[model samples]
Target: MLSLIVSNPLFGVVLTLGVYFAAQKLQEKTNFALLNPLLISSIFIIILLSVTNIDYDSFNKGGSFLTMLIGPATVALAIPLYKNLALLKKHYRVILVSTLSGVIAHAILIGLFTFILNLSPEMIATMIPKSVTTAIAIDISNQLGGITTLTISVVIVTGILGAALAPILNKFFKINNPIAQGLALGTSAHAVGTSKAVEMGEMEGTMSSLALIITGITTVLLAPVTQAIIHSLYF
Candidate 1:
């Protein structure tokens, strides 16, 4: 009975939704940044899977359907960008520079840290695209011959950390510009960070969405060059 239920595709979908809904409510009640819905739900799901003795492959049978939605969800980010088209046009140069800087800096910093730490080439490759969304990050990791699982783990952690710390970082750094805030959050955190951006304001959400898209494209284009550079220095 347990195996049969878990084998059904709807099981993963229902479990995910149920866990996230509970996490969302808990977050709303506590109003705590650390009580991030994504983080909480992920922990819960992991524990549930572990305790139930269900393997990742079994869970992913249904979870893959949800993963497929990531592309459309990413494309949905354009709605906010479209709504803020005028604002985007006005600050196009700033957006471009900031996105490019963040993407390059992100890959470079990860590579530098991993190199300094004497991590394997594959490990370095996995960490390179950690800031991008999972769908894009996985592709980049695969293309670079990195561990996709490790890359996804790093991406999730990066996103959760960004979502949790973005507000504090913004306040600490005295970042008042919405565009700056959005870019910082989106570029550093991806989708999860965009949720926080949405809470900040409409403009911030729009800019964050735009930043996410730009950062994904920028990372994809830069990953090969970054990989070559890392190989030259380390391999």
Candidate 2:
């Protein structure tokens, strides 16, 4: 039975969601920081992956289902966004400027780091869209001459890490304002971070959703320009 479970292609994803849901249950039962669903699910999946000889591709075959849901889930955020159009209209400038800054900062910071480290151009391309959600990131990476596999991995990692740390970082930086908090999570972390932000509060969720949309637009617009600049500098 155990061998069968391990051999199944979708085992990792099934295991991951199972762990995530279980962790959610634990959260409902107790107000414990240690019960974070993302953390628990990640640990479980890591352990499973490490112990088994199964390759990631095989695991992802099953796991890809969960990943596919990301698109629809992202679109669903529009429902909440539409519901809060009034608040959004009132804060349009704040939302617009903050998201633009976040997108610009994302491109510059990652580009600068890669440049300073003298990484390969291929690696730099792979990382250029690291701040966007996986779907958009993968598409942009391909257009920018980046490795799709590397771009996907970076997007997933960025989302998971951002979701895991945002709360603490938000508190540490004393970012109590919902708009700032939402934009921070949306711009830095993408969908996963936005999920956590939505849980934090309604305003945070709306702002995060807005950030996600605007960030996507900005990144798409900026990719070509940034690519031209990078080429001039490196080529």
Candidate 3:
């Protein structure tokens, strides 16, 4: 039954949904933060891949239909952005400053350290867009002459690290405001961070939704400037 199901192209999609449903139910019963549905599903998938010796390519073949939803979901993010446009306009100046500061700081830190450490130039270029979502990150990396694979890896690492530490970082910095919290999460973890912000509350989720669009745009605009600066400094 398992082998037959996995052999079908739709199996991955079905299994993923099944896993999510089960995990959600378990979360309701346990109320354990560490046992998040995403975490559990990810672990299950990873272990399945390892035990079965099924490479990502095969899994993706089966799962690509579900993965394709990413496009529509990203597009759906624009609805919230539109709804918050008025509030965004009111705080436009601060929003611009904060996002630009975070994005630029991330680029500089990654570029400088990677360059200093003698990492490949491709790696540095890829690292420049790590703070954005994977789709945007890959696009920016492609435009900046970077490796897409490395960009994906770094983006994942950045998101996981940011999501894991966001609460602690927020407390340490005493930035309890919803706007700041959401901005921090969106800037650092992309969609994953936004998920965390949603749990924080409506205000945080609103800001996070705004941050997602703002950060993506900001990173796209800053990528070239950042690449230029890193180019001059490192080369």
Clashes of each: 0, 1, 0
Q: Tens digits of per-residue lDDT for model 1 on 1-235?
A: 9999998988888899899999999999998877877778888999999998999988888888988996787677567668778877998998999999998898679777866898788888888899998878888999988999888888988998998888888889898998889888888999888988999998788888889888988999999898888788877
Q: Indicate the TM-score of model 1.
A: 0.91
lDDT of 2 by residue, 77-185 (tens): 5676688789779998998898888888877877687678876777777888999887788778989889997787677778878877888888898988988999888
Candidate number of the best lDDT: 1
TM-score, every prediction: 0.91, 0.77, 0.83
Instruction: Arrange candidates by TM-score, descending.
Output: 1, 3, 2
What CA RMSD would you report for each candidate? 1.8, 3.4, 2.8
**lDDT of every predicted structure (CA atoms):** 0.87, 0.79, 0.79
Clashing pairs in 3: none
Q: Is candidate 1 or candidate 2 better by TM-score?
A: 1
Query: What TM-score should be assigned to candidate 2?
Result: 0.77
